[model samples]
Target: MRKILAALLLALFASTAAQAKWYEASSEHFVIYADDSEEDILRFAENLERYHSAMSLVTGRAIETPSPSNRVVIFVAGGKGDMRELTGSRWVGGFYVARAGASRAFVQTIRNKSGYPHFSTVILLHEYAHHFLISSARHSMPRWLGEGAAEFFAASSFDSEGGMQLGMPARHRANEISYAGIPPVEYLLDPKAFVESDREASGSFYGASWALFHMLIFDDARKGQLTSYWRLLNEGTDSLEAGKQAFGDLEQLDKDLKKYLKQKRMSLFRIGPDQLTTRPVTLRELPKGEAKMMDVRIVSQHGVTREEALDLVEEARKIAAKYPDDAGVQVALAEAEFDAGFNEAAIAAADRAIALDPSRPNAYVQKGYAQFSIAEEAEDKDAAYATAMETFSALNRLENDHPVPLIHYYRSFVERGAEPSETARHALERASQLAPFDKALAMNAAMMQAGEGKIALALVGLSPVANNPHGGELADTARLYVAQLEKAEEGTPWQPEEGEAKATGNEAKDPVAEGAAKKPTGS
Candidate 1:
């Protein structure tokens, strides 16, 4: 029955196709998708690669280039309005989602506003700061620090000579700073106040957060205060007490930030292209069918609900049939089919993808996903499970460090009501380390660790999620995990309800909260 359905879908798609002049920019840290001119796409890709380089070197972080499959996939949105409409927010110019082994972002094309980098680029840069910092840090931090640092880094620019500047005054937040007033010092230091505040206070939080961070980073008198504060917090001190110890009087610190924000000229860093060494960016006009399928591919990569999948699978099938020889098109079809509950059809499409392009990694992932979906209902569960493992094993061989397959390895056992092997748990931990920006993945691993009495490790995993400035259920859930895990470390393990593991984080199901860097209520 499934085979016949699959055949009918392909038959219906036999002559369907669409048109778009799209370009792909492949670089060390990014895979860029743009429906724009080649010259423009190339220029943007170069700037992205250089920006990535500058950030890594400037921070003295040794973040290596991700595997091809792990590079952040950036989509150039139609315009600023499209970005705003995604989350129904006037303030959001762009956003990113951090999926293990498959992070992606959508942004309005970079442009200048008032002789500075546009708000779109600022939002993108701000989100990337969250991406980069979370990937490297070992523990959670205060919400103020996270937003402040992101704001400070987001206010940046690239020059014609390939030079870059950082720490510019956040002119984007100037209005909020001037009008919304400073968020009281307690708001900056306390998580409860940060979360409980209403819309106007939220705006002031960001404005005041940036002012405080910029002051700490650039002010001579505030040297080492930021480090001291973070160290105290990490050492188990409460945030308010840490702030007092590091910055002396809280009121004085607030006053200092107000004074700093009012200054006419603020200091910033200027580094030439020589200081930001980057890998070359490769650009090409996408193949006809692949170019035509950009919209479908973008939606699939970002993930979909069953309803969304139902809506998209027909278009995917049409494109796949029109471009029967295109592996990328087949991959898109496979994902659509899988998401729409056509598991057998998904496997068939993924098989075609693998045969068409042996080098494409996602084909294996599509097959593996479908295999996992159907294995439970199979008459011979053992053989079905083994076959799915082989599919993931093939992907691991292709990219040894690919995170999803490692996560799949861990999930294969737990999902089957069996105890995971030591090897499986190690694979999951390694995946968490490689993709710490995937806060959900870390949260899952942390839960497993907490269940097994590894409280310290669990805390490390949950901290970043708790402090996520995305500001919603996921952060709230993570804070709960931290509280529980900290108590467990102190000899009181709070047992979680059954089936709570998968329901903890704000995943793709929550469209508004998934991977959002800054979600101010309004204004």
Candidate 2:
């Protein structure tokens, strides 16, 4: 069953007492449906649950994972948006905790950012770590340690094919440090001190957090002291005291962790598209001797009559109709509609889910996605475009920190007209900054650059995704444009590249020559 928490009440309730309300913000409740392919929000959530349970068991503390009862949205977008949104929002890229009155909220927005689901899963786990920490502590833990513990947990990974392996320290943080500089260990120990400094510039925070946790938990000598240190922290140890108890020579441990993270080996668990399903219920069903349920669903969907996918959605909806208040049924119906490409129908079902229980953000995302799909199919130059714009605007208003909404908004602008091309480019740039490793978003941004006659810069953007499966087409298209640009620069014009790349604007250096060159090729 799905339940939506009211975001407004959550904020008000949270303001009164931090521990009283877990998920703050009652006005922002919605159900999030996990995508059934190449992603699994529920699996991510389950992993978090396991970690939380394990930690709580080990520490003898009531570690709370984010609310499983709330409507959680799971979806992917071309990683594209402001980096600050991901890190600054405190909840983005992690299992967020928001509450309204007695209700609660959670969301997991994982994507194929590093060209690998496993890597993204690590990122999602970090968020879950935060959820577990906050819930168990029931108090605002120090940011550095809280984030450090989250990072520590996030750096661990488990896979059926590869077994269990530790993940690398956050690259985002590492990059910052490499380009900028790191703070002293003393400064990091102080939560306020760490917060005051732009630790992002040095990337030291991520490494430092991981190092501290590793030494306290794994180092041979310090391992014996973990229990006491953990107990002290749980019992509300002073930051310096915790540091002193956790590691006798905290500075040395910090240096060791930094070295360990730098040298940590990561076996790229290249999970095939097959292992990357978003449906957790289906995945969990696998162990109960019902692994084929999802397969049956998929096969059943494929074997049915024309557009069987759509029919299956209708069937799910009909089943849901039998139980008017069954949030699960409503969510399932909406999922079916979404998978079937009945964007409008899916959106309506999602809306109904919200009406039944307004705390779920899943429905909001579904509604947003449905509208986005409709906008994609829009025919009219103005009307179709306007609808797409509305969809994106609604999405952003609901969650300013979410990059997915921004990605769609930027794309809509690019598709509709060049009048806002610059604005779209800026948005895309922000997306790249947030998720520098996302290929599709980068490709789109590069194309936008090319559209603005910044061909070299566009090529630079496209270079990153030149090898991935989804990026192959984009990479080829980008290369083709680069060739055309080079040819144009050399005064030897060639035929324009096809599709969006051909939409060259008024900045053509030699339109007459370009056209003449294409004329002969047409023959």
For all candidates, what are the clash counts?
Answer: 0, 44
RMSD to truth, every model: 5.7, 20.0
* Model 1 regions lying over 4 Å from their true place: 1-19, 81-92, 110-115, 195-197, 469-471, 489-503, 508-523
Query: What would the TM-score be for candidate 1 when compared with the true structure?
Result: 0.89
Candidate 1 lDDT: 0.75
> Ten-residue segment with the worst summed lDDT in candidate 2?
514-523
**Deviation of model 2 at 491, angstroms:** 86
TM-scores, all candidates, are: 0.89, 0.39
Residue pairs clashing in model 1 are none
* Candidate 2 residue-wise lDDT, 110-138, digit = tens: 44232224444555556545545544442
